[model samples]
Target: MLTEVNLAFNNLQGSIPSSIGHCQNLLAMSLSHNNLSGPIPPQAFELPSLSIFLDLKSNYLTGGLPLTVEKLKNLGAFRVSRNRLSGLLPNNLGSCVRLEALFLEGNLFEGPIPSSLSSLRGLVALDVSDNNLSGEVPEFLVSFGALKYLNLSFNDFEGVIPSEGVFKNKSATFVEGNNNLCGGIPELHLSRCNSKTSSDTSLKLKVAIIVVILGVTLVFSCLLILWFRKKKEQPTTTCAENSILQLSYQSILRATDGFSIQNLLGSGSFGSVYKGILEESGAIIAVKVLNLLNRGASRSFLAECEALRNIRHRNLVKVLTAISGVDYRGNDFKALVYEFMEYGSLEEWLHQSINRNESGIMRNLSFFQRVNVAIDVAYALEYLHHHCETTIIHCDLKPSNILLDQEMVGHISDFGLAKILSSDRLNYSTNQSSSIGLRGTIGYAPPEYAMGSELSTKGDVYSYGILLLEIFTGKRPTDNMFKEGLSIHNFVEAALPEQVIEITDPILLQERARQGTFTEFTLNDKHLQHLNSIFEIGLTCSAESPTERMDMSDVVSKLCSIRVKLLHPTRVYRERQALYIAQSAGIQ
Candidate 1:
């Protein structure tokens, strides 16, 4: 009756037991990162009920993959990389058309990749690198519209690489170490193919091309030298000044339909955001129009511009352009144009009741979605704190400031209160001071910030921790129940390692109920432990003392580990229990 088995990273030895096929209800199995050797049991692949995954990577398993793998037609993922497996890949693997991921790298797989695999159009990630795979890279892979990660590196592939579909993106495809590969997109930098023709004619054409290139290079070098000499006379310019879009006030006015109320996306202390479309390219965008009448609104605009001038990250909202000019009436006009996020802010999804459809059932974030958003925000903070030219403190980190795109990916926004730390004094910043009263939103700001502490990366971590707890618990930090010295931090801390299920957002619990996995009567220990670990991270991050809080880098790593555990829960309940106990006792 076992549905899942995850023994990864356990240093387990010996070969997989063929008797495992007797578990007819088994839906997922992960024996990766172990010392298991010997042939993968053909019986293991005979189970049609294995739908979720079968990960056997980083093991010493050997022998040919059994053709019986075709029986797992419903399997979502099939990974056997970093093993000693040899022989041609099973030609019948195409039967698993539902596969979203396939990892067969770091093995002895030989021969051309089977043509049957071309039918797996749903594959999101396909890695067949570090092997003896030979022959031309398959052309059919270009038709796999859903494929995002493709690795055919360190193989024997030879021929012109495809230039369409996934190949068009250099970041999405990995074709390095394949010496014979050529003629991919320009960004791949592979050599061009030679045509079958007379050697003399080809040599003459190459010499003529070289002569043209040298002449052009000589002229361009002279021009560049003159330009540099003249450039020294001009003043230096920041990225913000150089990259600002040349949109006039009239163009922005027309784009936002004369600042109509219907186009309004949201409003805040500094300004209002409106949905806009460029008349030239028809690209959708969000326009933040400053309310100059509001106190410090103009300063907020300058502060945001300064903070965004040099920083760029995937999890941080991209500022396409900034506008500062006079309107038709000769009044001050300031706005920031950004790529429109179709899903809106996280605040609407978490607290607003209007997310439901006609069915009236509330639309809530799945447990995994919440965890991913938390990770995304953590990555943003980590970049700001450690990866930037100078450390940046996003004084405000709250749900409302986090925007979601069409893919539900989180992007940190609203950096009007951001401060850049001086390199000599990493913790303190003279850019913004405690004399400006409170820096961030109420309830989300760290306790030390209220006592006039200098802005630091730890303050951002504290806010992120509070945001994480609110994401899981479905309660705002300023909830009425959190009064009389009962804060969201303690409310969650008091329930940790025991009553986590009771405090978790009921919407998540309802999702589990619909999956037939959990109910009030059947409390899954693994599920509870996962929740316990997440809450513990939040608690650790939100610790009152600045020195006691977990750094953003550590938070990101721990959250990613927890995400892996959530995806692959252990098969044996007792094993999970013992692991949790060991973790609790600080043995791991």
Candidate 2:
């Protein structure tokens, strides 16, 4: 009856069992980030009901992808990246027409990309980078209307790069480390393609000779002048300084009406946030002005700027620009401008008793909405920890730092306490000087921080676990009831599979009541089970031992499974029926 199997981020080994194919009801399977080795069992691809995804990335799976992949026609995502798989991609993979994401990067995939991929017009993200993929960059990619992010970098692709579709958008496409690539839009800065077979050789030679001589002369002249200049003479800028908009203090002052209280959005330990509208573009923005008088305010400003400079993700708040200059009174002023989120922070939506109408009825996040927000935040953390060039630890993760967009999608904000772990030293030891200070807010911060434990991604995971628990229970970690030995973790942990209903948010129960799913005397067993599973995930993530906590990736996978179960209870019932029939036949 199992529909989803997620065994990621574990030490599980051995090849994926071919017997797994017997589970015809399996809708999603994630065996990623594990030690599983050997070729992927061809039977794994034969599941027709796998509509969610089949994630086998970051394993030791080898050999070519099976042609039976065509069987997963309903699959939405297929990720087998960061493995040792080899050989040509299966041409029949085009049969998975519903796939919106296909990640095959960081493998031994060789040979030209199959032409059949052109049929995947619904692809939103396609990454085939860091492989042995060669031949001309496919022109059919230019026709994919839905493709938003494409990474063909670190591959053996050559020939003129396509200048249309995802290719035209520099930020949307990545084609770096392909030395032989040529002739894209001017923004790509690749060498122009030259005709190998010219009808008039002498004329072509003359033009080429003239061009080379002029190019050399110009380069040499520029190099000579640059050599004479001292390094200190040149002004240097960080990625943050160059990428953001240049806004003067006066413009920001005017935008926020001289930092008026009426425009105030919120305040943090380091600064105050205010709502503003740019005069020129009439665009709304959220401005964070630093309290320079505070001891670490300057450092916090630089930390935020550094953290946001190069990273871009839909679930993370976007920084419009940063300002660091003197005010009208000649005082040092520093601030950051971000795209304004219409719905404000998750804190308000969760705790604030705002009346939606004259009835004075309070509005609260529905159960489904809360799950979606948790998934969004998990995705952001996953990107920060695993996808970024340098691992980023949010350090401080709480409801107040989570903002909601107009669509009600959660975006993680406030990078003032963020920590960047260098790629070489991803984990720090307690003795490391960098581990000396305690970071992050109380109640949200892990217990190890107080003991001078090194800051790590686990710290962020612990914070996220607390946040997830808060979202469902409608109780803050610092709640008045959680005094003495009782904390939010143990508070929720004490109420497991049975008492989950008692501790769950009343608003959620009320929502179910409105839907006729719950009443004063009765509660749906399935609903209670789902809540139990969610609370278990929260408990596991916030476990006292850092080693015992689940990774953000695993947390995401488990939560996604819970969401799928909630949305497709009928499918679960059908699966149970099928299992019963098979078992009855075997008994006969």
Candidate 3:
């Protein structure tokens, strides 16, 4: 029946018994401010029911933090501060994902801060102050989504303090008494770093310059000889790129295992995509085989080729070329070949229980990786809506349609429903009515599209916004969780700045621990403000009234500003984004 053991402020003696692990009903155990000594019993940590907290602070506990600390998976707060716990912090403390406030301050802990601490995504307050922890104040501390209070004071932490994330506000994070600490935000008043880049690089550059000068003279003479010997070539224009060569039907069959299921990557209403390698170039390619039997599939295939050929951006999927001919059966086979993305699609990363690369090792997308992907998608849309020769409306914009390259960069794909707004086609005639039924995928399709409203760039913006929310929250716009007048839009809207954490994709939190970037928690004002701006952007972009949604230009500029703030937090970019959104939404 026991829920909490509050033996604090008592004069208890002797070490805690390992037998306490048998208390299956215990929720919180507080032996803090007691006269306990000796190493913490491993069995106490072994208890599965200890969830609220395990406070043994203000005691004389000895030995390193137990490796058994990971056993406390449900532990909320771990306070062993002001103890004599010596030795390196256990790397697996990160596995205790539920830990909110961890207080190891005033301990004898030594050695570099464990790189494994980056895995604690839900950490709110962490205090290793007055310890022997060394190394640069971790840059990853700025990356944790929920971190708030950090006390690293009186430690041996050295190197330049980063000026991003929670580090931007020196007042919130306590790094004082670490005399070696230098170069943080201007407000911190620490001395600037003497060497931003390594001095060795400068010396190496000088040596390279002298070698280049000598090598250039010899190369120039050789080049002159070769130029005379080589045949003259016609000059080529750099204006537009030519598409990749089109392969024959037989060659496509050879590249793939004769249309075998093993080579198939995915399938859709239009056709199935197969992963194949070009025999000549040895290059991996995705072969999209148009299912001619499906209505409008042929039209969709042509639309995709036309859309891809007319425009090219690094964030848009590249078109190798199209192959129009009969297959082995001679039953009319039409396929579009393109670059094969090793990472597949963002949908897999978001929804899959485990995402493995080509190597087969399971991988998780970090929070910032998703952010970058969002930016990549936005940049692609901005180019499509404005920078392209003809304004292209990517009628279908969903996570499955958003492919990721090896580097986790997002590329907008599937332009089957693409509507190019040419000058002459500005005023749509009766022909566009045919597209009313093919605006986009159901859940991702904007309300306007469902209502037979003319599809516009704003529709793509809506899809992208839904995609953005799905990326961060790990919930589909059409998740069964949505019913009785609730959608991803208002689900996010009701949460706003405070409870957004509750609705956020738990994957983001767990993936945070794996991120090399220091886990900067969102407890501080700076992080909350940043998330507020992001969620607001999602809300605004998906507004039911298409006209009220933000344009691609504004989306690009503002998303870029958010990124700039993350990279260089010297300015209040979150506040600026918030103000811009307020003005856009007409909030007084």
Candidate 4:
């Protein structure tokens, strides 16, 4: 009747016995910090009652990961890190759908991470760092929505580091040591990467030698013909076609009334944002005035202008005009005018900080409001990453960057660190990065940026995940209480489905409780179910491995489905509502 077996730190040696899986009642087993060797037995993962955990870390185990791992459907935690295991991660890991935690760090695992790993819906913590895994990080991790801890550091991961989900929480994740990583949050302090593909020196040398042998005139003619062909194949968008508005400095200044404190909306690293009204037109606008004295302000102004130039989406913040000229004092002045959002940023509604006005009281978002915000953000990102002519990575995605208009419709803003990938690259499974710079805020930037990863669309998905978590929990990733292994991701991941009420914002909890007693029981049930779905989406988007995060396209689809189930309940809920009302009135 033994259900748990603890054999940790016993200095055990030799391979695990094949007959160990015969213990049908064994719910937990530990043989960690030992000197065990050889391949993992197929029966190990097939054990019916190994639902608690199977800790075999800090061992000398070797060989490729066993494909039989799919049998541990009930397993909660699987730790094989700190070992000498080699080969590719088994796609069968997808079958272990109940796995809540996976640790494969410090192994010899190589090649591209399997996309099938996205099936781990309940996964909360994942660490695949210190391995030899190569290729672009998968985007499905963001789909896990339940993930909290992610560590991809010291690996061979290349291309753009994602900025979404757990990537937004710096301390919660570890993505350092891989030099090929680049273009994440500015807080990561990583080096910038060259956006253009680097030409191989050896290839150039070979071409020179061939040109000399083949005759310079003939080679020059061939090169000219190739250039023309490439040019002809390129997609072109005219300035007029883009419909980019051109505004003058005088017009911007007059609109903001000399950039008065009364008109100041918010201030960031680059400049001060002001609410303005055009002189000729009484239309309301939000003007961001760049501080020329600041080192990177000018660059940020240009970056935002470029990112918004050709992109258009209902959920995306619209740029009416960009002004570049000198101020009255002859100082260089640059500004961006955007459609004003009367309800303010999502950050103001979710947190008690930084939305200060004369009332000095903070506001909170309703459950439905938060879901709408998530949907809006997802749609905007999907357009930028998948639907646009040129794929764009919104290197900075946070609640503050998400503005809610008068109708509480969310709009994604702040593209100061956006990276535009070539449209041709989108034809492939994953897009590439051509950017080199520090990106995103400290608490919201992805970890791989510190290690110099490329700017990929998955990065934006990561940020969106963090934003989603913040909206529901009312806690920032950088909150003072979250430290030393405790993070917003872990905190929420620990309290899910049934216990989510424990960590949710008090306002939401109170509202749900109030509504539960009087509202139809099925409606309340559906609300909680909808909430659980959103949590899963947030976890998936914020996963440690970029490949594990869900793509923006998938995110939008999920959010829309949830919205339908919540707002327009099925006939079952309606029938239950009538039944409950009649029963209360003694009319049954």
Provide backbone clash counts, one per model: 0, 0, 14, 48
Give Cα-based local distance difference scores for all models.
Answer: 0.77, 0.77, 0.73, 0.71
Model 3 ranges off by over 4 Å = 1-241, 352-362, 415-437, 511-523, 569-588
**369-437 per-residue lDDT for model 4 (tens digits):** 777788878878877886556777777788888888876889888734333334353332221233323
lDDT of 2 by residue, 469-522 (tens): 999999889989999999999999888877998899877766435654645533
For 28-52, candidate 3 gives per-residue lDDT tens digits of 9889766688999888888778778
| Evaluation by TM-score, superior candidate among 1 and 4 | 1
Score every model by TM-score.
0.59, 0.64, 0.53, 0.52
62, model 2: CA deviation in Å?
A: 10
> lDDT tens string, model 1, 364-479?
68777898899889978987886566777777899988999877989998734333333333332443444332278889899987777777888888999899999999999999
Select the stronger candidate by lDDT from 2 and 3.
Answer: 2
Q: After superposition, how far is residue 179 of candidate 1 from its true place, in Å?
A: 29
